[model samples]
Every structure is written in C-alpha cells, then in structure tokens.
Target chain A: MKNAERKRWCLEHAGEPLTPEDEAYLKEHPEVRLEVERLALMAKLMSLKNHEEPAPHLETRCIARVQERIQSRRERGWLYRLEDALTLNSAPVWAAAAALAVLGAGLWVTLHTPPDAGVAAVQEADPGMPPVSLAAVGDVQPSVVQTSPAVDVASADREIPLNEKPILFLRMESNQLPHNSDQLIYGNGGTMPVRFDY
Target chain B: MIDPHPPDAAGQAEEVTDQELVARAQGGDLEAYNELIRRHHRKIYAMVYNMTSNKEDAEDLTQDIFYKAYSVLNKFKGDASFYTWIYRIAVNRTINYVKRRNKRAGLSLDDVDLGIERDPAFLELSARESPFRECTLTELQEKLNKALMTLSEKHRTVVVLHDIQGIPHDEIAKLLNVSSGTVRSRLFYARKALQVELSEYAP
Candidate 1:
C-alpha cells in the first residue's frame, strides 16, 4: 500500500513480499492498508507451504513398495519382460532389427519351401532350357511338349551380381504357345521369360 | 543401551552422486535405486499430499510414482537431473489420478510442523490484524486444505508446484505440457480463490 503505481506493482507481484521502501510508503499512507493485506495473505500461504511435511520414513516406505514391485517384475514370465523392454525404450534399435530379422527369416522359409509341402521334389531346371516359375506352377502338372523345340525364356540369375550373368533360354515353336496369352499359367508374357530366382 | 539402527547400505550409497546412483540402478544395483528414492521421496510425497489433500491417496500415489520411475529408469537419459525427472513423473501421475477420481477425499493432513509457530511469516501474520491471527495451527491447516481442495486439479497443481514446493513455473509448464503463462494464470487465480475461501474462517 503505497503510491497508486507502487501499490499496483505490489498487488501484481503477489508471490514476493514488498520492498522496504514500499513498507515505509505503506506506513505513511495507512489509508491503503487494504492493498497490503493481500500480500500478507500470500505470505501466510507461503508459510503454510513451507511448514507442511509428509509422514516420517516416507521414502523408506516408498522404497519398500517399489522393491516389491521390482521383485514381482523380475518373477514375471519372459513375455512380460519383452513388453517391459518394448514400452520402456523408444523403438529400441535392437528391437527394430530383431523384428526385421524375424520377418526376413519367415519370408525366406516361405519362399524356399514349395507351395505344396506335399510336393516332395525340389524343382530343377535343365541348363539348356528356360526355367519355369516354380511358385506359379503350383502343382507340377506333367505336360506334353506339343511343338518342335522350346518356349518362353523361363528364368535367369537376375538377383546374383555375377560377372557373366547366366540366362536360361526356352525356345518352343510358335504353334506350341498357349492358345490365349491369358492361358499361360507360368509364362510372364507370350514372348518374355517366366523368371525364377528360387 | 543397544543400538536401535544397524549399519545401512544406502547410508553408504547416499554419498554417491545421482548420476552414479542412476547408472548403478540401471545396471541392476537395487540399493542404489533405493538411495535415489531416499533422496527425493519427501518432496514427492508432500507434493502429492497437498494436491490430493488426503494422506492415503498421497501415500498410494507416491508409491506408484516411485515404482513407475524405477520401472522406467532405463528411459532416463540424464538430459535432466533425476530430481526434475522424478518431479515430472510425480506431477503428471498425480494430476492424472486427481482427474480420474474427479473429486477430493477427506483431508488426512499431517501435523503442522512445530516450527510453524516460530516461523517468521507466521509470526508476522499473527502480529498483523488478519484473519489467521487468532486461528490455531490445526484450524488453519484444515481450512487451508479445504480451501485448496476447492480448486480445480490443474490450478491446485500449479499452486502446489510453484507456490508450495517452490518449483519454477517453466518446469511446471513442462510437466503439465502447457506454457509458463498457463501456470502463472492458474496460480494467480488459485491464490485469489484460496484467500477468499480461507478468510471466510475468520472470527
């Protein structure tokens, strides 16, 4: 409670107490004591804040509870630990790498294994002729070569970065082509090879 | 007379830096973890207790907050000191618990420290002609807590953090995911409402 401007300043900054100059000003201008009472209340509240304490041995009890929890966590099955690790860290790099590895292994097993597990024979390609799409020719239907020589360039070593990339060629006479382009189950196109990497 | 307390491992670990304690705790040293808890649990408890205005809820929540900090200790990057980090955890969880409950329970306040009688602020206020001058410490504590419980959890939290616990508004804003302006405004309004509420107890 001082000059209007100074009183206003003290009121606005309630968190802190008044300056000594302002106390002198307030004593001289006792009429504005109403304004200074608010600061007194704020100081009272600050005292309340400082004087309160929680129960004794709070940390000791809290540590006990935390210990019990950690023990239970340790006793949890591996699945719980896995979830704990996943949530505890931000997309851990090892986790990401493990997920990719699992997917890669799953895909490798899927591609290498034949469509029909009953198809006991692993597919083979004659070095002289084009390879068939093993995946496309799901059930290896034995067929008669209706025409003279060969057909679509079936497969090649496309994935391998070899110095002289090996290419397999199949040359069947034009009459032996499937009656409709859509009828060629394994052929990628009427003229193009049905490439196989597996 | 027999010694009431034996030698304690944490007594030794207490001398270690928070950085060392955190590193050891991360490396599966449990005593180091307990020492870290010892270092901070009072402030955390006081914070939650004031916000909830109930001893039991404060106890439960404080325990849960520490357990949470331990469970997720690996995530602590030391980007902030352990004190700030745990305060962040305590503030966030208590706010959430307060909201979820959506109401205050009976105040199970602790005894006002005996030192409050001799506190300069208490002496100064009691000396002045004010509402608190004639009230006993217990009566003042109850009225204060009751008034505090009247505030919205957000406002109460800001007051508890900034006014009571002495945390900076910037830290409170970070904890609440709001701007420093919001903390200030909430505190201003909260203190205003409280002044009115408690002074209603005046003789």
Candidate 2:
C-alpha cells in the first residue's frame, strides 16, 4: 500500500494491529509508524472518556412520554390525520398551493364583499319591491302586504298597533326571531310588521 | 394486576426479534414498544451525550428520538434492522440539534461520572507520570469532552461513533449516510485534531 493509504488505514484502525502488507509498508516507512502511534494514543484517550449513564428516571420518563404521544395521536381525530397525510412526502406541492389559494380566495371574498350585498341583489332584481324589515314587518305598506293573503286573521286581530297606518301584525314569539334582529330582514316583498312578545 | 400473557409467552416475547417487536408495536402493543426503548435507550443516550456533551440535552434528545421513532413506526419498511433505523433517526436529529445549538451557544460539558477513576484505561493512563495525572479522572474526562467540543460536528460525530463508541467504519458510514472512505477520512482528521488539542496529556 502507498504511504498515504497505509497511514489512513492505520489511523482508521488505530487499536488494531496493522495487516501484514501494511505492516511491511509501515516498516519501510518508519515515519508513518510514529503518526499511527499518536493517532492510536488519541483514540485510546478518547475511549477512556467516561461513559455518561443517563439519569435513572430517563427510561421511565421516555416510556411515559412516548405513551403520552401515542395516546395524543390516537385521540386526534381526522383533522390531524388529514394534516399528516397532507404533510407526507406523497402530498405534492401543488395540492398544498391549491388549498392555500382556495382559502385565500374565500377569505378575500369574505373581507371585500359587502355584508348587505345579498339584500341589494334582491332589490336590484325587483326594483319596484319595498325592502322588508323583520322587526317591523307589520309596518310594510298595505300594497306589499296584499301580496300574501295567508296571514291568519286571528293572530293579526291580537296584534298591538305600535304604529298606525292600518298595521298588519304578525305576532311571532321572541325566541323565533333571528339572534340579530338588525340583519333579519326578509327579501320578499310580502312584508308584515312583526310583533315579538316574550 | 394479573399477568395477561403466560410465563412461556413472556419468555417468547423476550426472545422475539426486533422485527417482531416492531410488528407488535405497530399493532398497538405498548409493552413491545417499551421493550424496544428499554433495549436501545442507553446506546442512544450515550451517542447523544457524546455529540452534545450535555447530560440534560442528551436525555431530552434521547426521549425525543424514541418518541419520533414510535410516531413514525408505520413508515419503517423493514429494510434495515431496527437498530440501524433508530440510529439513523438519532444521528440525523442530533446533527441538526448540534447545528442549531452551535448557533445559539458553545458546547457545555457535564460532570464526568466518578466511575471513570476505576476504568482500566483511565487507571493505565493515570499510572504513567503524565501531566494528565495532576488532575483526577473526572477532570481528565471534563477536559477531553471540552477538547472534543472543539472539533467540528462532523468530525466529532465520526470520532464519537468510531473511536469512543467502537462502531465499525461501515456501520458509521451507514449511520451518517456517507461512504466508508468518507468515514475513514473524517476519523483520521478528527483524531489528528483531538491529538493536537490533547497533546498536553500525551505520554
């Protein structure tokens, strides 16, 4: 073996006896032997360094932690499973990009679109129709009220006339009304001034 | 708590191959998984301790390594022995950890075990009239660990695996994902660096 190769082999196998061929090569070049001895001593000292036993609690702690992790993963439902699947190497970059794009577009539409656009669309579709207020459905013009003749006369008879103008009261229970009375206007022109009595 | 498995079955469990344990673990046997941890935690801890030179970090990293291995048990293809597979995870995780730790702060050494004084190699070295004898084995261990930290992570890893841990070059190559030639070259350079660093204690 060449000197450099022999030296490398000797350093690599520092504690081990040199092979016959390498030994002959080293004998031929005694300078490499000194280098080999130095490397061996270094390896010996490095090996002599104390082995650090982990704390006695390490195994139990590790097992407990691992068990906790496994339990947590088991408890996680499909959302985490989906996340794992999406994070897998098999999940292509385009799929993630597409998902992000869809989310971003949905958010953009939500933030930019006016909250009352649906109401405006309904009015635009029939410009002659009056806007119906859910809170005051009884206050709708008689003309709009005429569109729906199905209003039960008995309920209307008991209606408290909060405002005059031949009010047609639709007495609905307070719980029946939308949580946000301000946003609960019906789109159709068949408006009735609603009276909610708890 | 009653023993679910018979005594013979428990004996069989002890004798089961790693592949069998892995299969059982994959099938939701917590005991099998714990057995694997019991089998390999020390070696893994030692490897991490050597690389990081901090006991607390080593303990944390060892736990993390096992947790990661357990989490991804399904991904193991059975191509490599569980030992090799776990070692791969450990080596990779530790390398990344060492890199991140290097950016944050310098390496820190733990107090060397008092057992080093009774070690045969340590006794032999301390017997000689050398500068290293002036200090105790624990001090020598501290100095060695500090010197080890001076080498680059790559060099330190090779030295720790090959020289200290006594892993063969081929296995070191497999663990580090490098060629045997690269392992040898790294060992050579690492040893040379360590030699110069510890020249004061040279006999």
Candidate 3:
C-alpha cells in the first residue's frame, strides 16, 4: 500500500475495531504486519525503559512544604486584615484632624484676634514713669479703681493689654471681678471692669 | 487481555481523592498531598526524561511538575484521573523545556541519549524472520531508538503513551487534553514515521 493509504487506514481504525477487509489486508501484507509487530515491541520497550523508581524522600518533602505554606497563611492572615483595615479607614481620620487644626488656628488669627506685635513695640520703646498701665491710662481715672471695688488699687496693681488693632495697656488694683480677679480698665461711663489677671 | 491491579496494596491507605488531596494540600494538608505525589511521580518523571533526553533536567522538571501540580491542586476536578492531569502537565513542561533547550544549545531531538544500543529487546524483534541474523544488536537497537526519538513531540508522546505504555486511545486523549480522533491521527503519523525511518533495515 502507498504511505498515504496506509496512514489513512491506521488513523481510521486507531481506536476503533478494524474492518474485516482491513484486518485481512494487514495480515497478508508482510510490510504492514512487520510494522505492527515493531510498534507493539516498541511499546513494551518504552514501558520497560521508563519504569524508574521515584525519589524516596519525595513524599516527605512535599508534605513538609505544604505544612509550611499553611503555617505562613495562618500567621499572616490577621496581620494582613489589620493592615487592610488601617489602609481603608484610618488614613482619612488623621488627615481630617490635621486639616481641622490648621483651619481652627487660621480662623483664630483671622477672625477673633491678631498677635499684639504693635503693643510689644510700644512697651519696649517706653521709658520710666511706670509706662502708663492701660487700666490707669484709660479715659477713666486710675482713682475709679477705689470706687469700683472694695480692694485697693495700690495693693493689687498689674498691667494688661487690650485692643489688638491699636493696642492698649491695662493696670488694675485687687478687685473681686465676677469673671476675672485682675481688673481690666474700662472707658468712661462703662460699667464692666475688664479684669487683667496678668 | 492483562488484568489490571492496584499500583500498591501494602501501604497505609489515604482516603482522599486525588482532587481532594490537592485541595487539602492547597488548604495545607501535606500528608494528604504526599500520598498523591507518591502515586504518580514515576510516570511523570519518565514522560519528562524521555522528551528532554537528560536525567538531571528530567529530575528537575519532575520536581517542578509536582510543585506546579501542588500550587494548582485546588483547580483540579474529578473529570479525569490524577494520572491524566499530571501526565498533561509533564508533557507540556517537557515540550516547553525542549523548545528552550533547542534555542540555547542549538540542538534538536536527535541529540538526546535514548539508550537504544544497550537495550536487550533486539533479540526478540529479529526472531525467526528467516534472514538478517548477522546484524549486531547494538546497530539494530541504536537504529530503532534513534528513529523513535526523531519523531515530533506530538507524535512521540502518542507513540510513547500508546505503543510504549500501552495506554488506550481514550486515556491518551485525556492525558494530552485532545480528542480521541486527534490521538488516533498522531499515533498513525508517529507509527508511519517510525516505519519509514526503520524501513532500510527491514527484510
């Protein structure tokens, strides 16, 4: 038979039952019969050639490796979860706190009051005569300290500054102010004594 | 027909399926998996060695095949025997290794050590054939093994599994991850190629 014809026949019957005609043909054809015998021989030889015993320690090694993998998973599971939770939620909270602190400090400086740089300069330039305490320096006479409270002014004299824009200084005698122990100087006709504690 | 026997009957038994063993190994059951490795390691090693033509590489590739099998054990289902699944892994890995080796060493499948000359089976093939008795055993065996190795990997594997290991076409299809038709085609071509290669020595 031609090579193509033989190949087609072999392929057609490879896993299936051979037709009686094809079987008889194979039995009669010396070349085809020899090849079939050779194939069967080759199969047996290949089987014998490749039957090696596997590594004796292969089983032990595989088991040990698997155990190690499981142990690692157990150890890392909680840590990974904690890391993920921290990553997902905690970063924004810290960021917001920092942002709020920055905002509050900015608002205090802008809306409520500015630092008294001007008052500090004035105090530094002044000489003698006990630089006029804002309490005594106010439009009200320092004598008003006596009429305002039971405590005398001389015993409780202290200086304080008020008004952030064009800064004012203050001094007051000991007085039982409702809000503050140190009295703050008030302008004429003002009832409240803004206490200066320091 | 030869009767099929269990590969081992004396050992302490493992109760899990191969897929279950792989799943347990994936989930951390080393002992369960070692049973799987012990069962199929030789067949995997043989398939790799035959294709690569080197013992050390075959050993390394065998190790790698099992490692790959272990890592992906969770993906295994019971659709095929563990033997077929690992056989596919062995064949694919060996083919890839051959391709890489070909690129690096500038060698082809013809260069591998096939041990055909040392084989004792030649005495049986030339038996009672009416002529050609004077040919040296080494010469005939070398010619045969060389012819076998020269076959393409696709054909070689089918021949090895079916002709050599006596695996059935359906089993081969499962191992190669192809249809029985494909296996049949490959076997036919492989056998034809071997016959052509060996035709000069025939009576």
Count of steric clashes across candidates, in order = 5, 8, 12
Q: Which residues of candidate 3, in runs, are more than 4 Å off?
A: A1-7, A10-19, A27-48, A51-198, B1-20, B103-123, B126-145, B196-202
- The C-alpha stretches of model 1 lying farther than 4 A from their native spots are A1-10, A17-33, A36-40, A78-198, B1-14, B102-104, B200-203
Candidate ordering by TM-score (highest first): 2, 1, 3
User: How well docked is model 1, in DockQ terms?
Assistant: 0.29
Local accuracy by lDDT, each model:
0.67, 0.71, 0.56
Greater DockQ among 1 and 3 belongs to 1
Docking class of 3: incorrect
Interface RMSD of each: 2.4, 2.2, 6.9
> After best superposition, candidate 2 residue A143: deviation in angstroms?
64
TM-score values for chain B across all models: 0.88, 0.85, 0.71
TM-score of each: 0.62, 0.66, 0.51
Q: In model 2, which runs have C-alpha deviations exceeding 4 angstroms?
A: A78-198, B1-14, B103-115
lDDT of 1 at A119: 18
- Residue-level lDDT of model 2, residues A46-143, one tens digit each, is 88754555677878898888788667768896765555555432236558778999999999997897554554454456554444323444444554
Which predicted model would earn the best lDDT?
2
Over the true interface, candidate 1 deviates by an RMSD, in Å, of 2.4
Residue-level lDDT of model 3, residues B66-153, one tens digit each, is 7666655677775666666667777776776766665333212223234543445534544636332566544544454566668887
Candidates' DockQ values?
Answer: 0.29, 0.33, 0.10
Please give the lDDT score at residue B126 for candidate 3. 47
